[model samples]
Target: MKPENPLTIGIDIDGTVTEPSSIVPLMNESFGKQLRYEDCIDYNLATVYGISDEVFADWLDKHGERLYDVAPVHGAADRVLRQWYKRHKLVYISAREARHLEVTIKWFSRYQIPYHHMDLIGSHDKLAAARKWQVDLFLEDRLENALQLAEALSIPVFLFDTPYNQGTLPRLVQRVTSWEQVDALVDQLALEKANA
Candidate 1:
């Protein structure tokens, strides 16, 4: 059931809002990690760099503040977040960790993303938190999280496309190729909800 309060939007980070693919190459080059575009989901740069999870987690402990410099995602993300910020309750549910919280806020302010309730999830299991938020609509880029949330919460999830997520998405989650399509989809969803 929809919350009686204003609809809360759960927005994903990385591929959804920030240029996650862009960062992969940067991570490969800068961190000396050899991660491919496809390997980023489960293990990510840590595996590519031959760094163990413990080491990578330690690195985050040391350099967590640097994530703010992550590049923007082609202006579509900021545009959507800004529009929703004025009308609905918005929470940025990022796989990005709590250690990076300060830098995340600074980054959003620096980039003018127009979101306030930023959540740094400990686990990659987004569906667990999505249920807790009681989101009306969830926006994400991964086929896994989108489809899982769709089945679990019956919430409409918009799955932003990437080379990896292609052909693997389920029917319950709508696929969008670009941020423009995401905006249009959100608008349509808002209108439908209003009418209903």
Candidate 2:
């Protein structure tokens, strides 16, 4: 549901707003594994690929920048987000490290993704940021994070569906597959709040 004030929406970046499989090609090339997005049932690539954490870290250190730089935006996200930005507070709370803030902002600018606030929290624990911002709703891709945020904040979370997150979700956590669905859901939430 919406609030009396403009809704503050907390959004995840990587697999949510960006092309869901944006990093798969890079990961495949880097690790010599031909894996598809549906094959990734876990968030940790190292585990999914059966590589050591140190090797994963080393690979990231070498290619992370390029990956982020070229990652594509999900279709219609720019238009929908820009529309929402006019009436709501769009807060991007990413698990990307604090050091990547500049590049992240640059990526947004490059892609023309509208946002009011950006927080590089460096981890998947986004509850604090959501609480701090008083986010009325959250859009996410990580199942664990969505579950935790919805349960902890007592708010609805629109989980962007991915193979990695295909599972039963709580009533408060709705699985969405497209930006159009997200926009419609937000409108429905606002209508429900207005009626309430």
Summarize candidate 1's per-residue lDDT along 47-84 as a digit string, tens digits: 55677888777766665455446666655677767776
User: How displaced is residue 103 in candidate 2, in Å?
Assistant: 1.2
User: Against the true structure, whose TM-score is highest?
Assistant: 2
> Which lDDT value does model 1 have at 152?
87
Candidate 1 structure lDDT: 0.72
lDDT tens digits, residues 23-127, model 2? 889999988889998898887889999999899888887887788788999878989998898778899998888888888889999988889899989888999
Instruction: Return the TM-score for candidate 2, rounded to 2 decimals.
Output: 0.94
RMSD of each: 3.8, 2.4
Error of 1 at 54 (Å): 5.1
Clashes of 1: 0
Per-candidate Cα lDDT values, in order, are 0.72, 0.89
**How well does candidate 1 match the true structure in TM-score terms?**
0.80
